[model samples]
Target: MTKPTPLSGFPELLPAQRIAELAVIDHLRRTFELHGFASIETRIVETLDRLAKGGEIDKEIYVLRRLHADDDSSDSGLALHFDLTVPFARYVLENSGRLEFPFRRYQIQKAWRGERPQEGRFREFTQADVDIVARDELGLHYDVEVARVMAEALADLPLPPMTLQTNSRRLIEGFYRGLGVADPHLVISIMDKLDKAAAEVISRRLVDEAGLDDEQALLCLRLAEIRTRDTSFVEQVRALGVEHELLETGLTELAAVIDGCADVSSDRFRVEANLRIARGLDYYTGTVFEIYMEGHESLGSVGGGGRYDA
Candidate 1:
């Protein structure tokens, strides 16, 4: 009898690792509930059009259908959800009248992505997300509060030291619009890959693949490389003659969040200017996040989510 081979990109955790994962899940659930975020579990499948609302997630979806069934004539195009946010959006839209304004909820579940996974990256992974969605608009304070709660939860976990990096979508969108970038989303996507690719590779991809010019790509690279412990990046960016109302607003909002976090302690949180963190999904609108473990920074972000308000 021949031994079976394990799948390439899919990973199976060991007994101890599984136990640790479960413990983490338990901690997250407890923290979320304590923060007044009610738990909600959505259906595993969503329609194609609903999933494709933002276009960023189209490449990651795993389409599904019944096996050995003769339903070829049917127009069913169900897909496994790539993240918790879209289903939450659909759920909120469907249950809007019955639900209260600023519906706060937390969902922890496995999401499937059909991309080629690398080391420490999986085709299917579990995500624990807590979000506050309002009917019209959620206040900015909620953004800071969400980050604070998430930071606290991660800090309490039995893991290495982590940093919470954040950026505002409204601010980025406003800045890109000011820069006259025809497709800011494309630029954002390219910028998101900065950590994975070299500067030249990312620059070429931005120009060739994203339709940005050489000068624009260099500017984007420069913007993405901006990092600071304080709000010094704001001054540097301003010195570069990059003046945009949205960018300024983003700078102010970032300052407030950094200051609020400083009240807790400066060591656990940082405001990174070069943190070109786009969650690469449709549901996130403002305040994106990416958490990095102390020594496992190259393993990619272990935890990430952001504010999404329509």
Candidate 2:
């Protein structure tokens, strides 16, 4: 008999590791429920079209197919979900009639992404997400509310200290538009690489690819460099000499979330307004977040999410 090769991305925990994982999950489940978030589980697979709504994510999706299936099998269109939000949105649409207003749901499930597996990221991994869906309008307070819940959850965990770095899509877009950039989204896409690429590389991309002049590129870099633990970031951005109604709205909203989370956040789990955290996803309309733990900064964000008003 041949010895089986261990899969690189799919993790198999030993008994002790499994127990530890279960304990962590249980703690998160309890924390979420205590905050009035009901637990729910979504199906593992969604149609490729539905999952492909975010174009960039399509490359990271694992398509589902049956063994020895026909060339044109109907199952070929299905794929394992890359994240919980897309499925949750689909669930809301399908079950809208049965759900109550301002639905608070906490989903803990295994999500699959086909991206290269690295520390803190996996091809198959358990993800815990808390989201509040409303029928019409959702107050900005819910943004702060969800952050508080996650902060408390992480603070209670037995892991290293964590920081919840946050930013606003409106803020980034408004800043770019105020700078008179022809395409704000294009600039955003380039700015999102600040964490991975060096400042010089990003500056070159902004000028060559995004068609930004040297001055505009320099300002964009300045905006991305803003990081603060309090609302003082408002003045920092204002000092840049850009003004837009949406920029003011994003500044106010981002400040509110920072201040709101500050009250509940612990020393172990801190919150900061990090402008470089422009989530690549197009759906996120308002606030965005990226969670990082001490001593594991190189692994990139262990967790993140944002408000999708659409």
Candidate 3:
């Protein structure tokens, strides 16, 4: 008999590990259901064009093809979904007519990507996501609502303590535009790499690549450095000596999220306003989050997602 070699990214878990994983999944399912978030499932594959809309995520997608398909067949394209959000958005549009307004959905499924495998990185992994989709508008309170659900879910698990660090896209967007930044998105892309990139490297990129003046770049970088365990981040922004209407709105929204979280799991979980934690996705128009274990920065964010108003 021939032996099969283990693949680097497509991991295979042993029996004990699989058993432990099932227990975690069972807990999450129960927690989500208790919060009135109905469970739903999307197909494992979606069109390549749909996933491509994820910006830089386009490069990490894994396209699918039949082994015996003709070279010139007219099929447009197909790819394994890289994450649940893209597929869920498509689902909302496809089933809009039959569904109720303000749909709250909880999905747990395996998502695939072609990225390099590392300690907190995965090529194929199981993910649990809770999202609220509205016909036109989603209330800011749901932002806090979802976080509370996740906080409770984490507390029930047997893993080490974790903190759900949050930031607002509105906050960053308004702060940058207020500072006279030419391209805030470009600066955000660079800022997202701060953990691996040096401060000087980020500042230089902000100047040379994004064409921001020294003053603006410095302010943006300084804003990114602010981290608070509670609502104190509102004061930190004021201390920066800059103001914008959008910044005001974002601060209010973020404060609301934090305060709402306190009501749900005060002693069970932690929430922090981490300004530097900008998600690379541009669609996340409101509050954003990244959860990590205490003192385990090397493991990276174990779970995260936020509002996508579009």
lDDT of 1 at 161: 74
Rank ordering of all candidates by lDDT, starting from the highest: 2, 3, 1
* lDDT (tens digit, per residue) of candidate 3 on 1-310: 7999988778888999999999999999999999998899999989877778757778888887777777735544888988888898899899999888789889999999889777657798898999888898889988988998999899878887888999999899889888878887888888888888899898998999989989888898899989987788999898888888999999999989988876654444788889988888457888999998877768888889888876
lDDT of 2 by residue, 1-310 (tens): 8999878798899999999999999999999999999888989999988888757778898987788776856687999999898899899999999999899999999998887866656788898999999999999999999899989899989999999999999999999999999999989988888878899999999999989999999999999889999999999999999999899999999999999987866779999999999888467999999999999998878889899886
The true-versus-predicted C-alpha distance at residue 69 of model 1, in Å, is 4.3
lDDT of 1 by residue, 85-188 (tens): 77988998889889987788999998888877676667788888888888786788887888778877787777777787777776666667667788888778
In model 1, the Cα lDDT at residue 271 comes to 39
Error of 2 at 98 (Å): 0.5
For each candidate, the alpha-carbon lDDT, in order, equals 0.77, 0.91, 0.86
- Best prediction by TM-score: 2
Q: What 10-residue stretch in candidate 3 is worst by lDDT?
A: 260-269
If the candidates were sorted by their TM-score against the true structure, best first, what order would they fall in? Answer: 2, 3, 1
Inter-residue clash pairs, candidate 1: 226-274
Instruction: State residue 37's C-alpha deviation in candidate 2, in Å.
Output: 0.9
Query: How far in Å is the alpha carbon of 254 misplaced in model 1?
Result: 1.6
Model 3 spans > 4 angstroms off = 69-76, 117-120, 265-268
